[model samples]
Target: MMAERLRHDGVLVVGAGLAGLSAALAAAPAKVLLLTEAPLNHGCSSAWAQGGVAAALSADDAPELHAEDTVAAGAGLVDPEAARLLAAEGPAAVRRLAALGAPFDQRADGGFAQSLEAAHSKARVARVKGDQAGRAIMEAVTVAALAAPHIQVKTGAKLVGLLQDATGRIRGVLARIDGQPVEIAAKAVILAAGGIGGLYAVTTTPAELKGEGLGLAAMAGAVIADPEFVQFHPTAIDIGRDPAPLATEALRGEGAKLLDGAGRPFMANYHPAAELAPRDVVARAIHAERAVRGGAFLDAREAVGAHFPEEFPAVFAACMGGGIDPRVQPIPVAPACHYHMGGIATDMDGRTSLPGLYAAGECASTGVHGANRLASNSLLEAAVFGERAGRAARDERPASGPYAVVTAPELPDEALQTLRQAMSREAGVVRDAEGLGRLMLLIGDLEARHGRAASLAAARLVAACALNRRESRGGHFRADFPEAAAPDRTFVTLDRIDPAGLRYAAE
Candidate 1:
């Protein structure tokens, strides 16, 4: 079918999460067209984030300390320069949101209230009334984006393909709107689509985020970095929900305990810091406990029992809806895919390897998240690098040439479910050569049957990369290898991947 073509002499932004909204807002007087697959405050992970934004906000903390924690959590592959930049700009990013009417909780001295999470040396996470940070922050940003004079938003517009010129420069996007194809042209395009959590059967993110943006960029020959590293949040409330509700790590920082089904604390046996250990350590410990014991649970009865309603209302409500009052009973927990540390490789300004295209938020890897992400830094990266992407993208001169849309076949629902289950089984918290090889075979079979859908492409990248790395480091753990190798990052373009079978390729 022929696509209906439209042209707008400005910048086009994809996805309506924090990153896309921030980019559109920062574009200022320049006209901005923002497109999303769902309504504002829906489908994006930003609104579901419970732990709040990480920043060096308190008197005792500095950006250097925050950077140190970020690097430590990333497990040796973090770029020091990018980590420093993210930490240094994090404070101002949090304050900027507050200025835009985000209702962040404050202290008696009118300072922003903070909380400590796993791996942070200081109480640096600036939050709302506990778990309400993502929702509250998104509400404020939504209002601002809607009110911005230069920004026009089109909700329910699903991105399907990228429009590129002959020289390999991105010119615009091909979107499906109301079941019809529409090609929208612009000077520059910023992709802020969320992560690949939907690829796993059990994840803490919305089901719509299947890494389409990452896949589209890769198919267009953009560099993908560390696609193997997938972060599993240690404590997703396992209430038989499709997308599990996350019990924020801040609960642990607030003194929650990880206990086996036998009612015994087990984190002490896993690491010295016990409940305060880094997220990767805690997640693996929980995974091991769930295998030995019937299940693992987060016990907050002694920590925030009566204060649950006031402090973590979101979690409290979710637990109640799931027929468990968090105040009295322990919340059933599991390691669920929470974040993707790898994505379309970009610089601090969100500039991708491909010209005329930029990326931000979870879809863009600025190297701050390395092998694993530090807690609460996702939102900060969205605001800081997103603003830079907007400012940089706005300067692109208009191009007047014929552009072609790169399209991929859509996978059916059943096939998607099959892929998701395999991902959680083979590529979940702990990985091995056998499981990874099986996953690659499964991906190849699915693609052969359904063609190279974006979801499959993204899944293939993760499986192939995980299969090749052969060492346990951070989120991409290999039980067979069982140890860390010399620190190095994986970078690949889609063209380098073998089309017929399971294989890893490089630049």
Candidate 2:
């Protein structure tokens, strides 16, 4: 039977986040189709970001400094070339966003109003209003994308698998649009579908992003790199919300202190950088604080004070919604799963292990964020690599071909809840051999029950890799192996998840 395929002549971008949208926009005049699980301006982490993009745009700062900071923050295993690419081309990406009408905050002197974030060497994070950079930038980009003539947006399309031609080259995806399975064949497939934040019980990302792109690519035989390194944001507002709201790290950069339940400042006791410490440090600190009787909190009253609404609208609204006043009450905070530093391995030009398969943004581990990611670099990476992927795919349109449809396993609600609980309990902020082994057991059980669900597939990759690595480094902290060993990075394919090997060689 002929595949029920939807064929597009140009590039097919699987996702509508910063990377996907940016790719579509960059692949101008080429017929670009963006397949998203959500509508134009919703369900993407990019829209929820508050700290804004990091670039060496300030006159006093340099890209070399930014690159140094990125390497320092990545713990070990950060690719020098990726950091160089991000640092060198980041300013241009931000400039292009500005030209596209992004409402970035500007100084009185008319330059970008950049702010300091944790682990960054300088105040290089550009903002919008105060904490509205992500939403504002995405809104502007969405407007531009909608106006673009060559781009087509397909909302409500969920990708399940990748398609391959007879020669085993990448072509497109198998997606379910409006609940109907359909094959999509294109010249090149760009997987910008974000990360695995939604797989955790508590996260700062939309629940829809359950590692779909990463899982799909892995299932299609792409080289998955560093799947064990997951970054937990230190200050997710602990308001008992499903997708916890974030207290922008810029608040800490502006002097907000991390406190405990007894209204005592605590970050200074943990790290010299205190609240401005690296994200992993802060997250572990918060987790340790919570482990103690004193629960973690982010006290930004002194930082934003009466200007909370203007300086951080999203946080102000979330606090108000949760019946907390940021001016008086120290917002309850905890380490929530915020970002994934590991994903489908790709190159500087966004080429994955498979030909015609490319990835950018959170889904692609371009070796930029090795074990831990620098604050505000995620958005910069999306812009820099997304454009590269777009330009690469623009003229590489392949011959139209057939595709295969592989549907996701039908996971019951209870099984998903079990998976979430297991992920949080075992793979949350810290890890150990026992916990990882238990996690693998649960993943195996879930796989047996659900028959290869994409979420479980991705979750298993993380657990299996985390189980194999025996040293603490970057975002991956093993309580059993608290010492950092020789620096290394993990590279795994689909068949190796039962037991993935770690490599110490440079890529």
Candidate 3:
């Protein structure tokens, strides 16, 4: 189908989550056309975030300490420069959101009430009422975005592909609205389309996300960094729900302990930080415990007890729905695909290899998170980098002209499901060369069969990258090669993938 032309003067931002909203707000005085696939409040993973935003807001806390903790949590692959930037600028971002009217929880002394989450060396996360940070922050940003004269929001619009010039500089985007494809010609494009969790069979992200932004950028030959790293939250409430409900890590931060069915604490045997260990360590420990016995759970009984209702209302409600009282019993738990630490490689300013294109949030890998992200850092990354990208985009003038809108290929439903199941089975929390190799072959076959839906292309990139890295570093664990190898980042572009080098036979 020929794309419909829609002209906009300022920037075109895909995804209306925190990053997209932040970008739109930062690019003030410049017109922005913000596209969202679902209703403003409903389909964003940002609203599901429970641990709150990590920032050095207390006088006793410092950005340097936060940076060190982030690097440590990332397991040696973190970019010190990016970590420093994220930490240094974190307070301002939090304050910016606060100034925009986000009701952050304050201490009795009127200071920010900061809590310590997994892997943090200090109690520095600025939370809202228990676990309401994400929802509250989004509500504030959404209201700000709606009232902004320069920002125009197009809800229920799905970004299908990017429009690029003959030399491949992105000029705009091809999006679908009410089943009709439309072309948006803009001066600059910012991709803030969240993470790849939706690509897995079981994930904490919205189902429609599915890495479309990552694939679109990659197909345009954008460099992808550390595509192999996918984080699995160690404690998602396993209540037989699609995209299982998340049990906030803040519970652990508040002293909830992980125990087996036998009522024995197991985290201490794995990491010194125990329940407060980095997510990867804790997730792996849970997976191992489950493999050995039945499954693991979080015993918040003694830690929070009756405080659960007042503190973590979301988790408390979910437990009540499952006929379990979190105040008394342990909540059944297991690891679920939660975050992606890697994405379209970008600098601190969020510029991609392709000119005229910028990305932020979970969609862009700015190398700050490295191998594993610290708890609540995803929100910080979105705010800090989203502002940077938005400002830089607004300052630049697009080189004159319209570009051809690239049509995205469609995929069969069966083929897409096969890919999701395969990824969840093989490239999930625990992995091995044999499974990863098989996964690559399956991805190749699916690509050939489905003719490359952006989601499938993204799945291929993640699976292929996971297969190539032969070490068990951070989230990309290799059971066969269960040790770190040299410790460096992995970068990939479409040109680098050689079909002949694949270990498994193509279907």
TM-score of each: 0.99, 0.96, 0.97
Instruction: Choose the strongest candidate by lDDT.
Output: 1
**Candidate 3's residue-wise lDDT over 1-507, tens digit each?**
776787788898998889999999989888899999899977778888888999998888899999999998888899999999999999999999999899999999988998889888789988888888999999999999999999999997988889899888998999999898888888899999989987888787788778889998998889999988999999999888778888999899889999997999999999988999888899899999988988898999999999998899989998899888999999999898899999999999999999989999999999999999999999999999999999988976866665765555866767767877888899999898788778878877776766777887787778778878888889888888898888899888866776632632332
Model 1 deviation from native, Cα RMSD in Å: 0.9
Instruction: Give, for candidate 1, the lowest lDDT window spanning 10 residues.
Output: 498-507
Model 2 agreement with the true structure over 1-507: per-residue lDDT tens digits: 234767789999988889999898888878999999899778899999999999999989999999999999999889998999899999999999999999898888999999999998899999998789888889889999999999999999888778876666788888878888778888888999999988899999998888978887887788999999999999999999999999999999899988888889988998899999999999999999899866988888888889898888899999999999998889999999999999999989899998888999998999999899999999999999999999888888577545454446756778888888889899989998888788877877777767888888789888888877889999999999999998989898867654321222232
What does candidate 1's lDDT look like per residue over 255-353, in tens digits?
A: 999999989999999999999998899999999999988899999999999899999999998899899999999999999999999999998889999
lDDT of 2 at 320: 92
Worst 10 residues of 2 by lDDT: 498-507
Model 1, which residues run further than 4 Å from truth? 505-507
User: What's the distance in Å from true for residue 448, model 1?
Assistant: 1.1
Off by over 4 Å in 2: 1-3, 400-403, 499-507
RMSD vs true structure, all candidates:
0.9, 2.4, 2.0
> Please, what is the whole-model Cα lDDT of each candidate in the order they appear?
0.93, 0.88, 0.88
Q: What is the TM-score of candidate 3? A: 0.97
